[model samples]
Target chain A: MTPQLEILITVVIVSSACAALGVFLILRKMAMMTDAISHTILLGIVIAFFITKSLTSPFLIIGAACMGVFTVYLTEMLKRTRLMAEDSAIGIVFPFLFSIAIILITKYAGNTHLDVDSVLLGELVFVPFDRLVVFGRDIGAKSLYVMGTILLINMLFIAVFYKELKLATFDAALASVLGFSPVFIHYALMGLVSITAVGAFESVGSILVIAFMIGPPVTAYMLTDQLKKMLILSILIGIVNAIVGYWISAILDVSIAGSIATIIGITYLFAFIFAPKRGILAMIHLRRVQQIEYAVKSLLFHLYNHEGTDIEKEESNRHSIYKHLHWDKRFLERVLKKAARRDYLSVNKEYLKLTPEGRKYAIKSYEVL
Target chain B: MMFLESLLRDYTLQIVALGSVILGAVSGILGSFAVLRKQSLLGDAVSHAALPGIAFVFLLTGVKKTEMLLLGALISGLIGAFIIISIDRYTRIKFDSALGLILSSFFGLGLVLLTYIQKRPNANQAGLETFIFGQASTLLKRDVYIMIALGGIILLVVGLFWKELKLFCFDCEFGKSIGFSDTKINLILSSITVLAIIIGLQSVGVILMSALLISPGVAARQWTDKLSCMVILASVFGMVSGVVGTLISSSVAHMPTGPVIVMVISVIMFFSLLFATKRGILWRYIKTRRDSRDINECKILINLYESALNHEEVRHAHKTTMLKPIKSLHYLRDKGYIRRDYLNTWVITDLGMEKARNSIDKNRGERV
Candidate 1:
């Protein structure tokens, strides 16, 4: 396979895995912990590199995963204390670990390939060059293999523990009574997150890793309610972002990771504006249209209900009803035309009168309101 | 002893130490409010968001004056925070997404700008990277003085608004019911949060500044239940972490002060998490164990009383072989729950028998 195919495959695997894990994190409100893990893994990577003196060492992944877990552990430990909130705990721990890694890089390994920039930002472009060869045959990019394994593991874990995860995510007390250990599930999910972070760090870098983990899942969440549907939607969104983001970057000659992240942001924006049932625009438009329809119906209903009154008794001065109702003339005219078309009202010469159907519809609306 | 004397003697080190303490105290006092409001991530977001502002200022002015740059940073950070709040209020997007959105976009924008600035013929842009990871060594007397003064102003504001802050955080609806504008309170609280982030950004850098703000609040939280006490303790924790971190970094060869400071704060947080009274892990463990042990003892006594009741002669139950049970039973007997006879058997004492019956009655009550 070509390098381009390798890169695409890597992006798909990594993005899907991140998105799958992102769903739970976003639901549990632990997205920032994923961000924290991404940064803290730097310390693990640096330490591993210092020991093995090779970036390709398997120890790097192991070390990074340990640090990622350490981040979660520290955050949990801090949270148990009354002195700090969960966000503060995450805020406090990861930066310190990241700083230590940076210090080590600048002091001892400054001349080496290990540096703060590469560790924090990563080289997504170089991901395809780092091939994993077996028996003199190029198997594919090492990142693809690593991320693929991580993705497979995540999928399996999610499948096996779907019920427990759902129960814990939605209501921990319920899960506890059902003989499901929420804490165990939580730690297991976090562990999967760590491994995924380590795998994705090589291909996407730490900064964009958050976007991968948070964006697609959040977008999917806005569009669906069912956990199964959400997971599926998130994976689909992730794969779309990877492919579209990659092509966009290739066309624009910009950073692939940045492009992917920007694409994710754009996708979220689109979802925000257009997603059915929950989109902001849809809600606003629905509310406006409902209000307009209500106003029109209410005016006609009030007039029809008070037929014997002075305003309704004088059918020759029907335009005067607009004044009593305090509605705009233009709106009244438009509503009158719509009502006439629907046979809700009849206009004769210079007067307006409601038909039997219009009267019924207006009364129904008023009653409902 | 030598290190202490040397630390006191060096004026620059003393300034750095004093500056860090002041910064830490400020962050701690404000952080108590931030943590209470559950806006802890706001500090992190603002700090990251400030990057674009700093980069923008540098790009526009072509200068590296800390004050001017920070002013721009403050404005942009506030804007970012405002955007976050507005997005959360208006959209279905959750708090985390809003935070992520502001954080990534602002930081990404900053990076793009920094990269652009680097390609220009400007030497001042060289130190922009330092903001990503702070350089505490570059702090001078002016920086120290600014930190102290700003920190003092923040502390004063916190002191004056302590009651209002507490009321707003504990119950905003109540605060509003009592003629307080929740919006105004929120604005004030968020402004303070943004101010804290901006002030700390210069010394702690973007990545670690949030830690400086949060860690002390966390550590202090573990030690106290009262808001006032938590704030004071958090300030003290922050100050100590700052001072110790600065000292460690200065003393150690090639140590980055920001990370060192963060590490110190983390250590303090860890200690408080494990060792604080009432809610600490250790305390909770001990309390749980003690309660379980008491319950177990009660169970054993009840068992002994139940077995004793089955005897033909309850008064002469001392010779019963069934009385001598587990080792814990013997210990319970020594505690006056049971009387041991010469035949290596046991009899339930009147007090023990009564207590055991009451314990059994309580268990039955629970079932009912």
Candidate 2:
């Protein structure tokens, strides 16, 4: 396979794994925790590297996962003290841990292949250079194999505990009462997050890791209500993001991860403005429709209440109605025109009259109010 | 002694040190307000958002001047802040989710711009990347001057609006009910925070700038309950971390100044968590232990008094049955709450009985 395909596969795999686990994170309002984990896991990898003396050692994943959980634990601990709120606790703990890792890298690993730069500003192009081997046969990019396995682990975890995870995420108190431990599931999920973060760290960089983890799930969430659909849609979004992001980076001659992050942001912006039900555009339309309907009802009711009175004849005319309602000429013309179009009222040269159907509607609206 | 003398003699080091200290103090002060308002991560979003502005200004003007770059940074940071406010106000997305979205998206744009600039010949984009991870060593005397001026302005604004900010942080609705213009105060506070972050961008960089902003407040919070004291203490902590981090990084080979400063602040936070006077873990632990011991002492004294009243002969010795009660008896005896009679009978003294009754009454009162 071409290195481009390999890089694309690696990107897809990383994106899927992050999005899959990210569903739970976003649902649990733990999205920012992923940001915190993505960063603090750097410290775990650094510590594990010091202990194992090898970059590819499984210990790195374990160490990073442990650090991820540790980050959550510390954040929670600080929060439990009642002194620190959620954001402050996370803001304080992860940066401190991340800086320690960065300092350690600059101090001890400056001459090594692993440096702070690689960790922060990830290199996807270099990913294809490191190939995985099995029994002396070349397989594919090392990142591909690593991320593939992590993806499988994520899938297996999500599948095996799908019901429990859903129950716990939506209602932890009930889940715990029913024998599903929310705390355990939360940690297990965070552990998986750490592993995914570690796997994607070198390939995508930390910020992009966050962008992928949160962007797809959140975007998918905006477009759907069903969990199953959200999961599938988020995975699809990830795949599309990976491909489009890769091409964009290739064309622009820029950072692939940065391109992907930008694409994710663009996707979210699209959903934000254009999602059918909850989208900003739809919301604006809904409000405007309701406003116009309300104005029509008020106009009909006014005409219905004063029909057959001598003063009503003058008050119900277009000009007098405009003055009575104190509406602008254009607005008055529009609402009156709408009322006529809807057959709720008839407009003669100088007088307006409510139809039988319009009388019923006016009485109904007045009674409801 | 040598390090101190050299620090004074070397103009470059002195400038860097001074710059860091001012950066620390300003960020620390504003951070306290941000943390209190639960906008701590806003610092993160704003800093990352500044990168695009920096890149944009550099591209448009083709200059790497610190003042111009910082001004660009301030604009983008405020823009990011505005986006966060809009997303939160107009959508179902929570504040945290909105913050993360703006942070990542803006940062991505900045990275693209940065990479694009890197490819251009003669762009002199050598120092641009440092804003991501920060390179304090490259800070020049002029950059220090900019930091000093900005820092002074931020501190002055915070001081001038101290009461208004305090009301704003603790109770926005109350401020509004009293006819204070919440929007004006919010704008001033946010602008000051942006300026503070822009100053720190050169030394601490975007990645860890949030750390410098928040850790000082976190540390100072452990020591005080009052807002004024917390802000002052946070500033002091921030200055200490900045100075210490710079000194250590300079002394040690290959140590990056920003992270080292973060580590120093973290250490201070760690110590404060354990040992701060009011809210420290040690103080709480000690209080609980002492309270339990006093309760135990009271229990044993009450038990001994009951035994004394029940005994037919005052000389008859009543041996304690339980291990805990025996230990408590020994303590009571030491404090003259109990006496050993001729036959080795433990007798409750007048003082002991009085103490026992007080303890019993207190326990009963608490339960009710």
Docking class of 2: medium
Candidate 2 at B302: error in angstroms?
A: 5.9
Q: iRMSD per model?
A: 2.6, 1.3
Q: Per-residue lDDT tens digits of candidate 2, residues A32-126? A: 88889988888999999999889888898899989999999999998988777899999989899998898888889777677777776689999
Candidate 2: residue B192 lDDT (0-100): 89
lDDT tens string, model 1, A200-315? Answer: 87777776778788888888987989889999999999999889978976775556676677678678878877888788888889987787777768767766767677756564
Which regions of candidate 2 deviate over 4 angstroms?
A285-369, B176-187, B298-319, B322-324, B331-368
Error of 1 at A274 (Å): 5.2
The candidate maximizing lDDT is 2
Residue lDDT tens for model 2, B155-265: 789889999999989999999999999768877887888899999898889989998888899889889989999999999999999988888888778889999999999
Q: What is the TM-score of chain B in candidate 2?
A: 0.91
Candidate no. 1 TM-score: 0.79
Structural similarity to truth (TM-score) of each candidate: 0.79, 0.88
